[model samples]
Target: MSTVAPRFRSHAEDILDALRENPDREALVHGHRRVTAGEFHDLVHRTAWAMQGQGIERGQTVTLLSGNLPEAIAVRYAAHLIGAQVNHLYTGLSADVQAAIVHDVETRALVVDPRLADRAAAIVEAVPVKSVLALGPSATADDLLALAATRTTDPFPGQAGPDDICAIRHTGGTTGHPKGICTTYRQVREQRKAGRAGAIETDAARQLVATTIAHAAGMLADGVLESGGTVVMLDDFDPADVLTTVERERITHLWLLPPLLYQLLDHPAMGHTDTSTLRQVLYGGCQSSPARIADAVRRLGPVLVQGYGQNEGGLISVLTPADHDPDDPERLRTAGRILDGVEVEIRDEDGSALPDGEHGEICVRSAMVMQGYWKQPELTASVLRNGWLRTGDIGFRDAEGYLTVVDRLKDMIVVVGGHVYTTELEDLLNSHPDVRQCAVFGVRDEDGMERVHAAVLLAPGATTDSDELRALVRAERGAMYVPARITFPDELPLTDVGKPDKKELRRRATTPTT
Candidate 1:
């Protein structure tokens, strides 16, 4: 960890100091407007004071529903200053799912972006939240900006301890209902410190944040601001907008999931845009196609950096820009070496450690790991055993210490005869030139036997026979690995966090057609 002076009380303090240091520097940019560091700090202070006035106390939860707006960042820092646990609702989730998370966290106050006021109102009705603050005009909630204007722009008197719960980030809910991961101020600080030591550039990083600030993009934005960098926020992701923003802002750092990266590559504007200023293009959240990643490196230069992490384990590993080499294709398959000061071990079902080259659960022990799941001791204990977070991902370490994630344990196809990993089949399907994207899973047949099934999205104006695709899989991995059914869908459903919605896919695959 980077040595910190005693004056820095918490992560919020560090940011406040950074903001003060560069008062005139651009802290956040959204559409046509930009907020300077000084202005942003004052906004955060007022927001914190307003929340305190609304009966929000330390340890209480403040749930926010917004995109990557300037107000969202302010509210997050405001919650941090007042020592309240902030829960960011995944905007893509259904109202019911978002309501469940609010109730699960026992949110004392709810904040909404004007665009999502209806969704927030639904959650407010479902949960017993005491207060509702909206970023803009709203019929059902108090206006946060209006309230901030009335409040003094002085720092909140209350300060959070290092061990205080800073944020309650929910899981992506790829498998089932999402669970809140308890993250502390100290954990976040340590992760930032470690990130700065490696991937985080020392020079001012002009970062383009096109994804939801509720997830990894938010974390990166925080780091950039703390290091005296600029955060360029986007309300929603558009391929053309991303390319244009990178060029317009001379964006040095950006983060995207593999799927979004593919879209940018396919977009006509991608080749025409000037992306020379981009120093790093961080990607994660799901497994990526090696062929697509290599293609990106060729087109966009060697700016691709793959980050492998979860809500529980902050950042386990990162495939650095130096590692993205066309000649060394095998390294691209790995999730990169274990992060500094993080211990990653592959363990069997019995909780015994497995040797290198053996596929098993990836367990992590690090300062960045979340404290535990919120208010779910049993569920927390199931994964957090002996201070090691048992990441449900099935992966193995190579002889060179690189981690290669095979598939999610629950998503593994279990046939009557043997098991089939979805990733293996997905990789094969993705290799086809005509295939834009694909998802593979196990579905029950008429005889109640689990069978391999696949849903694919073809490239624009491209066509391929399902039988030929199935035959390709059969020839590569034998009959057992071949999908029993292959359907060409316009597009596969995606989870709120942008991962392939395998749970939804299984439901669709098993549903009887008329």
Candidate 2:
């Protein structure tokens, strides 16, 4: 009988094919370093071969701790091609948390950056991984790059199938332990495909990725590589450097969080920066300042795209560049229409679908939704009902097919005589002239009763009193929506993933004074 070809295609192989098409073309840039498609291709294969030599095989987990380096990207693909699941230790998380994650994933190989050698050694001391490979020569770990250099550049078919586990990205660790969101190769591939298609499939574009590559930028980077585009990596985000890079690189694509976007807009360089070459600025992680967004649209051309989704469900919807209309301000508040190949429904507590305008839990169904929370079958069952993943976000759909996510299902504040939606108040606060940034959360008193608490960051030279803020909320939303206790913090806390850190905010509100 003739040999049968596998049904599933690996995303790694997709990059390999793209790399083969133009070996000499510049593929990646980091400061002074320039890597061509040929070099990146060889790096992926060589890393894969080196891992295999260390006995890393299919179904094993490969955890990484590194900055946004080109080799980190190669390591991710190399693990994928070898059928190893990948997980990244986020920079902001505590060592204990990272150790717990490493133990939870049962990581077989720990690929670390030379800079993070101490952190990697700490993890190894606690978790005892089978292999410790450093991106470069280090005191604690063996040099993986040196070993890879000895391997041939011969390409091999990917070891994993479509349904095999490709990644186990953990949640932001808001709730006790961070739950690992396990995604299969098929789920990951389809998610990227849908994202690329919705964003307009392009052949080539220079994209600047300034966020953490272990999370949002990771998927975007894969898409950029597959399209034969150049990715300019930034170790850290400086509004000045980002603006300069855009003007220097003639960057066509740029992705950033809303806060970072606002900083870029307000930066002094923004006035002189040549941002006319920008094609689109993809932003989404949390609620954005509508005023700043409109300002960006006025300053830059009409090229603001907002992606709305969570880890449980990939990208559920996107507010396209066209949706950022200056005239229709109400549309700016919306999360936009559901993406293609994705199904979204506003369901009530009983799991029944609600009609438009009725607020309920936002549920989504698509090939992109995670397979399940890693090894948590019961938890998975509670959310994934009949192929639909229940996103804990509470929102309603308008008649025009736009989704508006209000307060989170868990974040609904139970006040003295009624309930308060945090977003309702935060949105109102964000509209005020003096408010720079704010996060509203509920904290329990000694009687185990919840009261509204707000941590706000006032704009420079702003003297808006807490009384005025409360008065504004009372007038706009209602008395109940006003913050019971308002504290003007130096800065609002944000999670590693860029979302508002309500947990930490709540802790601060409840904790006793020194």
Which residue window of length 10 is worst by lDDT in model 1? 194-203
Clashes of 2: 0
Error of 1 at 31 (Å): 1.3
lDDT by residue for model 1 over 7-88, one digit each (tens)?
A: 4377777788899898999988999998999999989989888888888888899999997799998898888888889999
Off by over 4 Å in 1: 1-8, 200-202
In order of appearance, the predictions have TM-scores of 0.95, 0.97
Which residue pairs does candidate 2 place in steric collision?
Answer: none
Candidate 1, lDDT over the whole model: 0.86
RMSD of 1: 2.5
**lDDT per residue, candidate 2, 1-514, as tens digits?**
8698856678999988999899999999999999999999999999999989999999999999998999999999999998889998787787889999999998898899898888888878888888899999887788999999999999966888888899999987876799999899988888888887677333587889888898888788888889989999988777999999999988988888887887788788899999999888888877776766887899988888989988779898889999998667688888888887899899999989999999899999998999998888999999998889999999999988899988687888998888888877777887888876778889888898889988887888899999999899888888788788999988667777666789998888878899
lDDT values for all models? 0.86, 0.86
